[model samples]
Target: MRTKFFIFIFTGIIFAGGLLLCSNIKTKEIQFEPRQEFSNEIKISKTFKVKPGYKLIVESDIADVSILSHQNDEVDVNFYASGSSKYLKDLKVDFEEGEGTLTIKVKRKREFKFFNFLSEWGIEKAELKILTPQNINAEVKTAGGDAHCEGLKGEISISCAGGDIKLKNHTGSARLSSAGGDIIANDINGELEAKSAGGDIIVRKLSGSIVAKSSGGDVKVELINAMGESEISTAGGDVIISAPSNLNAYVDLNATGGDIEIDFPLKLEKKNHDKLKGWIGDVKTGTKIKASSSGGDIEFRIRKGEI
Candidate 1:
């Protein structure tokens, strides 16, 4: 009996030691160190003269882009490039100009077979800042970086594969999408459509029609002025809407696995715990707002006077 007890104690000690070693390994794997140095850095600046209503197009593989409106009729392009020594040596920016359009593209001199794997470690980054006329139409595309634009009176389209998108204080229509990042738009005056496959979407002070959808994140919108219709949905997140106190619109809210909460008084056309169909004020305007969530709650409220 004593030998059996000794054997059991030894086995227990060995098992505990193995578990402790694994815990240490996991902690080390999650620990991160800040990067304090880069092997290469490059800056390029160019200016292009164009008409007032010219079109600006930009494409990049791994760069964050910022496009803004300026008073001048010329577009100023500035590129700030930095990465490892090998990546910096191969980076290139190409520019082309047509009758009423300007195009800028960033490319690499030689393709690295393992660039996709290395990029996950954040070994390189390039950022572009473009300033154009206030009324120029803009289109921007990036494979792995954020995109931002503001103060343009023409239509704008932006897409990013692995980063956020932001549009602010613009009078033109906008269509934006991201594969794995959030989207935010504020003070927009025209039609807006935004979608995210794996992140949240928030829009405030909107004056036109809006359609926002997300597959794995929340959807929220605050209407400053309702000119048309609005529809927002999410598959795995909450939906929240805020409107003015005296707004006249029909609202329909639904949640599949959660509650529907409305913090304002409504004239009920239909009512239930998980679904609500009502009008904020008179339904004479025929304006409609719909919000739905598949696996989360829905909240519709009246905006405070501060909004």
Candidate 2:
């Protein structure tokens, strides 16, 4: 028994010493095949016949989206893509059609291969264009691209995850949002809501009410004939608002780290370097105009040659 016990202890010590020595041994570094990229071009086209109350919903993984309207009561869609899928297969689309509703959803299933030398990795850029019936409600979104919509009537919402959003000749209730880019609207009416995460919000020739906010960029709004109780705020950029000379608005402006300036006649209630509350034309029957900035100036101006 003593002899057997001695042998077992000796074997255990030898095995531990071998493991300790093996821990210090040099090993080859892992190498991946020099960042190879694979890309493809894809084109998709679809058309749908619609009724009186139709709705269009489109979603893209990474694409530039554009929407336009036509006279006929049909919705046409076209998508063109030419780029890599960034280390995976191309995006898969699911189309769903229901009673007065059409949906196009794009999705990508991620896959990771360990010890893969031929993995594909690159950006995927795409363009989506849609021609729709007039006065159709629509909801459009992109994961990482720009968006442009023109002449779309009815309630509409457009968004981009990492690019700019532009609206031209849009009417009715509209909402625009961007995660990391600007929001620009021109020749719009009705109601609008614009938001940005890291870029400016610029609206021109707007004949409606607006609610705009930005996290890290400027806010500029130019109004036309009439406006609703509008509110514009920013976290770290300037705010510039312009309206017609005879417009009636109850103005309330504030800036935490900058100045406030208004180039209009007013029954000034309160005035300071960073705060102002007054009325532009009629105090009793005016829309509320509120703007605030935390780190930049706030300026209000009358329309050119109208004051």
Model 2 poorest 10 in a row by lDDT: 112-121
> lDDT per prediction?
0.87, 0.84
For model 2, how does the per-residue alpha-carbon lDDT over 1-307 read when each residue is reduced to its tens digit?
Answer: 9999999999999999998877756454556787465566777888888886588898976668888988878888887766664633546667899998999876655543453323223445567788888778989998767889899788989888888999999889999999999999999989999999999999999898999999999999998966668899999999998888888988899999999888899899999899999888887776888999999999899877321
Off by over 4 Å in 1: 1-38, 111-115, 119-124, 305-307
- What are the TM-scores, per candidate, against the unseen true structure? 0.84, 0.81
* Candidate 1 residue pairs in clash (backbone atoms < 3 Å): none
> For candidate 1, what is the lDDT?
0.87
In model 2, residue pairs whose N, Cα or C atoms come closer than 3 Å (at least 3 residues apart or on different chains), thus clashing, are none
Give a tens-digit lDDT track for model 1, residues 132-153: 8898888899887899998888
